[model samples]
Target: MREDVGEVTTSLHRPTTDSSRSKPVRYESFEWPQQQQQPPSNGVPRSAWNRQHRRLSRWHRPYTAVLVFLDLISTLAASEIADVFLEKSKSGFQHKSWLFLQGSALFTFFAYVVLPLGWLLLLWTNGTYDRRYLGLGSEEFKRIVRTSVTVVAAVSLLAFATKTDLSRGTVATVSLCALLFILLCRVTARQVLHLARRRTGHGAHRMVLVGTLPEALEVYTAVTRSPAAGLIPVAIHITDGYAAARGIETPVPVYAGRDVLSLVREVGADTIAVCGSASAEPGELRRLAWQLEGTGVDLVVAPQLTDIAGPRVHIRPIEGLPLLHVEEPTLSGPGWLVKNLLDRVVAGLGLALISPILAVIALGIRLSDPGPVFFRQTRVGHDGRTFRVWKFRTMYVDAEERKATLEELNESDGMLFKMKHDPRIFAFGQKLRATSLDELPQLINVLKGEMSLVGPRPLPADDGDYLGDVRRRLLVRPGITGLWQVSGRSDLSWDEAVRLDLYYVDNWSLTYDLSILWRTIWVVLKRKGAY
Candidate 1:
């Protein structure tokens, strides 16, 4: 069997229509057969194609197998532990005769065999083993939790329907322990996978980006920014016709989108990411999906929506058409009220717990510099209200007066001023800033309800007023630390900082605040991007 295809490389030169400007423009073009004109297949045997497809896409199988083994161990250990606990407490449930087993034998049979098998079945049925959710995002954990809930509900319903005297304590203990153990195993597995991807690019998808030049480049940038997400671009398929005419330069080999299936096969790409309006033609996307049906290539559509978190977006299928519904941001309401209440409570407790350290730092600051122990500055707060933000003095008393001399040395690219090594910061102050202990005094602001435990960082009043959409950051109280601070603090560009702040304002929740606070601890310990 042979595949019929044609490839041609040609150089064309066209002279200008005007005699006064008769300079010829030269360009290179490569042409291939149209989509319908190309061969239906690569002429490989079906068996050989199956073998090749498995070889190309089974890279994650070993990782998935490891998770399965871990889950098995977790469930078995949980059952045995529950059995031991029940036995020691003299509260074991009596098992009546069932087939050839009775009493202790029957209990052991169910505990050792039936329980683990049922747990694994539930996990499989809940899609816990899906490769897409394995090593990224919170979906894997969420699925595990959902599986655990299902197990509890199923067991309870079975006991009720059968009128079996099932021990409530046994079920709760086994379910809770199994959930914890499996979650721990998954966290460890995810960290290992992330490390492998970062170090060796292992277990990553070989992605082919399909879109116009600009849209493809945008998707490429976003995916490549976080290499841990594991969508590696191997080729580009330009959907628009003007790419060749304008001679657009791309990071990877560029092909006309007329034959994306052929392009994927040629590049050995396992994922095709369609970006922006690449499939604007009617039924074009569905046709592409049809072409990729059994070839083991995953088709992913990258919508133009950027920075929208998953919780706010929902897919509602109406008449077999999926419509994306975006819930409005939780700027106010009961959830916001809960967030504000928790902020004050956590702040108050933090201030009380860290009072001794605060005093020691204040004394050290007074001894090292002749300035006030606390540095107070007016900052724009919620609703554009001006609040006096407090921080342990980390600069000289005359730091404000010396600002003029260092204005020429500004290293930051925004309204803010930042220098990696500023003469204004004293020795003790550098230590304070390095560990972010300087920001601890802001807990007082948080306690006073002028700041939040997690939100956008408040800007100094003198540091240019917020303009345009940037003012949205003021909808919530400024934070002691936020996405901007944990992301890179002084290292992020002005626009990037604003983008993160706006993202926080649009996605604020108690869970988000807690995640930020957790990341802040790690960022502070690493002392990354700090002066």
Candidate 2:
């Protein structure tokens, strides 16, 4: 065996869990890699962890604030467009710009003023406004939508009773347009920002891979395949001879059979992504993590089950020890009502607002090729109910018939079938999906009350067989936009999608609804997850 000690340092170290706690995990003298030694036997300094936390948050805080600001603007603009058109238009023919302005101001006042107050109530009632919920998922968007609707309804009633002379055409036009336009702007901004971060390197966090060579390679392949994620893998450190002999050469340097703690220090790595199932002693894992605790580095364990998402895996503390809890997904009761109400409101609004866009898409589809303007498919919805989900036709007439033969090229996870670069899509269809204009027809499903503004995903009935604990998802109506669509859409593993839906089910609130609606803008505009 050849020993290439690039930078070797050794030290005897003690692992401490806390300065004030009772017994800590005691370890004898350990041979750390020849990179760096622990400071004189007392303990490893703890300030390092704090530094990493600050660094990570510093990068994220401004970006999040930008999102919030953009969301506010969307709400304002939508209302203004509606209001301005109404104000300037005559009795029969409403002025579009005046309606837009009126809608923008109304939506703006409603969102920033009325909705914030409701959020305060929600905070007092259900703690929905806690900072922890921000950027978590669709919950925040759900609340925003619901609160805005409430304000709109209240204003509608007041104007009617007070004889305020607000034109129905104008009110409807402005209200709908404001919401749509505002959402569009926010989505556009998010995609731009995410891409900017990926390119600038300011948005991503770096991690070192730790495992057997094979397992490390698996993780490397996965991370590298999606550079848009902003993860920069700086180096690889193998813990065994088996990994070292694998002949895998990475762009970054590799060190073999090095002590984990030493590698963390000298490499200046702030995090470690543990891969594969190697039975390392529990004591050793704890020691390595404890030694690096104050350094701001983190340990992320990649379990063998690659299909599952974070929300599905729950950790519980049992008798002073931690336990992982996996819950069955289900939607029930008030969750259904909240979802239903949102569906009705959003569907009504979408149909009205997108009428022009729908016409445009329909004309384009018709002109591109000879076929019906709309495409209908039998997709399963709430309680296994079958419904015809609609989209502006994006494929040839025989697409469904051709689907069976092309199953071999399916590149999706779980029961969901997808082809990243499917040839079946018509020339114009690709652009439609990328911009999400194709799904506009599903607004009819919303109006028919077969779907919602937001809920668990809708799947093809035959595809239902692939589900495990998936029926819980159907307790509420399906949506044109749902947890899966907003989070990562086609890019997610089936398990990851299920986890998001279940999270929505377990914690269904108006706030969650608002968050999802808001996120839909970015999901559609970024078009990263669209096929």
lDDT over C-alpha atoms for residue 243 of model 1:
36
What is the C-alpha RMSD, rounded to one decimal, of candidate 1? 8.0
- Would you list the C-alpha lDDT of every candidate in the order shown? 0.77, 0.62
Best by lDDT: 1
- Give the clash total for candidate 1: 0
Question: Per-residue lDDT for 55-74 in model 2, tens only?
Answer: 22234556656655665565
lDDT of 2: 0.62
Worst 10 residues of 1 by lDDT: 8-17
TM-score of each: 0.84, 0.54
Best-performing candidate as measured by TM-score: 1
Clashing pairs in model 1, backbone N/Cα/C closer than 3 A: none
Poorest lDDT segment (10 consecutive residues) of candidate 2: 22-31
